[model samples]
Target: AEKGTDRSTLMDILWDVQRRKRYISEDDIGKIGQAFNMSKTELEGVITFYHFFSTTNRGKYTIYLNDSIVANQSGRKAIQRAFEEALGIKLGHVTPDNMFGLYRTPCIGLSDQEPSCLINFKPFTNLTRDRVFEIVTELKSGKRPSELCDIPKSIIHYTPAEERTVFFKPYRQFSSLSILNTYSPEEIIDLVKKSKLTGRGGAFFPTGLKWEFCRNNPSEIKYIICNADEGEPGTFKDRVLMEEHPELMIEGMIFAAYAVGASEGAIYLRAEYMYLRDRLEELLSKYRSQGYLGKGIKAKTPFDFDVYIHMGAGAYVCGEETALIHSMEGKRGEPGTREFFPVEKGFNDRPTIVNNVETLCAVPRILEMGISKYLSLGTKATPGTKLFSVSGDCSKPGMYEIEWGMKLRDFLDLIGAEDPCFILFNGFAGECLSEADFDREISGENLLAEHMQFRFKDPLEYARKMGGIGLRSGGSFMVFNKQRDLLKILKNVADFFVAESCGICVPCRTGNFLLNKKIDKLILGHAEQQDLDEIKEWSNIIKITSRCGLGKMSSTALNHAMLKFPEVFEKRISANTDFNKSFSLEGATADYDRIINEMTLDYD
Candidate 1:
């Protein structure tokens, strides 16, 4: 093995080894162990733990189909039918041409992308039969299609001519999310200060600022956490980071540990990421044994740091900082208020620092590239690139990283999305956008401002309002084509929110449950104008009164449904304006009883 290949290289070696045939045998394993200087037990542990690290040959193009709620809603079975019919293969079966391998993985964060499929390590979600065929044909021909595929002739004439710039390229290899191992606290801090990198895990907080805050705080045993539990719907960018560059994450954690005076670090990864977890653990062991970690000489100065991987027991709410801390402590993953930020009172009640997986992963580049260079590449307020899981109505769906301030058109083009019918920013519970919002830039300031403009409008006006509604933290845009029923789509989204909301507060728990019932009633061809009015009233009340960001965002579904897709509700209301459409007196109450009964899946 070559010396000083970096932590990520070790993971690459393991990945390469797993793809070989002879390595499956005991003798081959021993030889491989000797080559990498690893024990047989360690080698075997790594190979067996991960489901993806196969000893047999996988085709050049491997496909991972994730079965999740979004896929379920979008008729995932239909997507499978389309792919199999088009490709001449069944689930988990590859084509004879060796051009593709098919397998099933769990959900990627982008539920909209769920029923999500990976083609040659790239993601494509929100698939339709027609779209799937287009993708397969394009791939089969070895030509990657671009977002221009979705442009209608009416709109095409309005678009500007494609222009080239000196500094910017239309495409480039995504910068590897890796970092050099460093021990010195001052050195690590200096690197962070120079990189001008901001955290990719929601909030877009400047990473260097976070380190500076934790470093200045008075705490002897500070804790640093990498929030790897990517639970948001319509977002799956983090998983790619883990599978492709596990060591960059570790190096980032180590650098953060040093900067903040943290001796130990923990990665709170989601249970769904079992494959990534296995690969990461194997990489950690190998890197440690090679003196890449611990005191006295992985490289130069002495820096003692170690990382532990803790699996989360699948809860969406646990993505919150407080809840994550609770989960790590073996407690119920419920959140408390932000009276004392995690930086002041975190894990085990010690001064702690929690950063997202993407945030930690970006640390090394900041060290390598220096701050001024980093700052010059992105917008002034939000420097550095943002990663997005672009799926939904787009033809070529995948995770993309682009510098801040890039236009929405450029972004969609980079991700190869055809024109979107409607874009749902943030997560499932966020606002839905019409063509009116397409030209707007995606950024923290723009999203916030757009949402607030809708604060005082009628339902439709409010829905149409731009800004303040997009994903500044974590969210994906779900695209809907003209063929799809917008009303049914909104109801499907409402059903998911009602099902997932933890029954903590009345607004979220009871209120959301009721909202879904009303939407369902409208979809079933029975509802009154009064019913729609009541739903809106409840949305406002719950939105304002609910605790945490989840509840506040939950109302967005109802808000958008009323404003953006008013015809769905208005059609029923106009027919029953006289209040005589066979709605029983107990129609509202009885539905609640039924919903409560079916709340939990295991309520036997």
Candidate 2:
């Protein structure tokens, strides 16, 4: 190997890795070393810096169990216990027979999804322990499993691109190494370098890149946090993952902790996830008992790590990473400026890495599949599969694991969107899509490469111009049927933004109140152009000057809707409509009086 340079791709090295020991060769190490102009040991150092690489052969049939509140509340633990009892194996251990390996994943936030399992990489929802046992028994007996339960079929396949494009589906090569085994940090980082999986949370940051940042930071104590609080109005993917495969998530957490040199981690679930909290506690106890956690994890491994759960009081702002960290510190949830990146300053003023449930869960897979395999799956920028919480007007709305480059029409077809409806990315509680402007590819990174297409002129134009919402912001898709009232929806949304203003920013608090009143006047058929201008002005000001992304983006929800569907607002304020429906000026006085009286105390 020359010190100056060499011409070899990562794929060449990865192939060498795949060719060794009936699996891949460790010689892939020297290939990468030669390419990067470094020694093999240096290449190994970089590989061990992250949590997405694997060094061992794993079982053919891999079982990823999600243990979170949504599933636990729906009774996932009992199902897990049943699976363990039936298999006569522990939760996180693979069987000696290599028939199966079970690991828990943190909440993927598919709350409506019943207890679930990932069978041979395909998600099987609405499951129980008996159901899992039946599937396992059938697979073991070499018998095609019976038409067991009503697990809904989804067209969303989440394999690497080569696998997706390979038409001649040879019988799956059931290799023990195909299943992800224990991974070292360097291996995880190398795998990530290969897969190119970005975070599944709203921001869509590169998972590998983030690990690199935290790893390189000169901090004594780095921290990684898993944000499981699924409080977005129509988003619930995280909750589902927690309930169905808690340990898979735990594995992801452990992987992250190892990658970033973090000793402690926390899963922040919303207060509504009480069941998930309890289940996680039980799983943690099991892992600790097995010595998989605490001071020394992985057979006296020098790396030290532990995970804990923190329940949030159900504030939407807590979804923001900064706010969640603050709340985890026992303070009111509110976001601060992103002046210093969390990679530099986080938990206890240490460098921190915060990722959502789905992002981390993808770690084990990326490690097993390799970076190039992961990169081949989705769009160029948005590589790897994504978990989506589909709610609202669509038929069979639930959590889906889809490729990033998939089309909206394709998604609609997959979910049976034969009827016309509005598409809302993020949440119905977030933004509403009237035209297909948002109908482009659903990968945030890819979309950013094309430049963010935010402002829209009209609904029809929007559809034509919309490339796609970037995947970084937790690639969520919500559909609203025509039966929904657009104006009424916007009004409700505005009211919510006003109510949840936190009273920290004066412009947000007062301006939102005025905007609410302005909407009321418009709805009451007493509005003017001047009023509309004022509402827009105030909303714009608040949008520009808010303290956090929440306050800043809050106005966009309504403003976007107004631009896309102004007719809905105008039509709702007809002279024939009931004006009283718009406001309750008189009732407000009585409500305030009641509040004042309730706060009053008698001398007696």
Considering every candidate listed, which one attains the maximal lDDT? 1
**Model 1 spans > 4 angstroms off:** 1-70, 73-75, 78-197, 296-302, 413-419, 448-472, 565-568, 575-604
Estimate, for each residue in 1-604, the C-alpha lDDT of model 1 and write its tens digit: 6533332233345445544431255766676667666777866654554445555545666666665444655578888888889888898777887666666654555453455565543456556788888888777787642331221111011121222111112222223222333335665666676665555655444566667767877888788889998866667667767765666677778777767777777888875564466678887787678655555424334456777777664467667677778767644465655656566788877767778877876666555555676666556655566666655666555565666666776666655555455566665667777666667676544643543221343422322231112234564556665555666666766666665565567888888888888877776656777888898899888777766556667767568757876775677766655446665668769988788789865586
Model 2: per-residue Cα lDDT over 295-322, one tens digit each:
8665223567888776554466677777
- TM-score between model 1 and native: 0.66
Cα lDDT over the full model 2: 0.60
TM-score of each: 0.66, 0.63
Model 1 has an lDDT value of 0.62
Model 2 per-residue lDDT at 382: 60
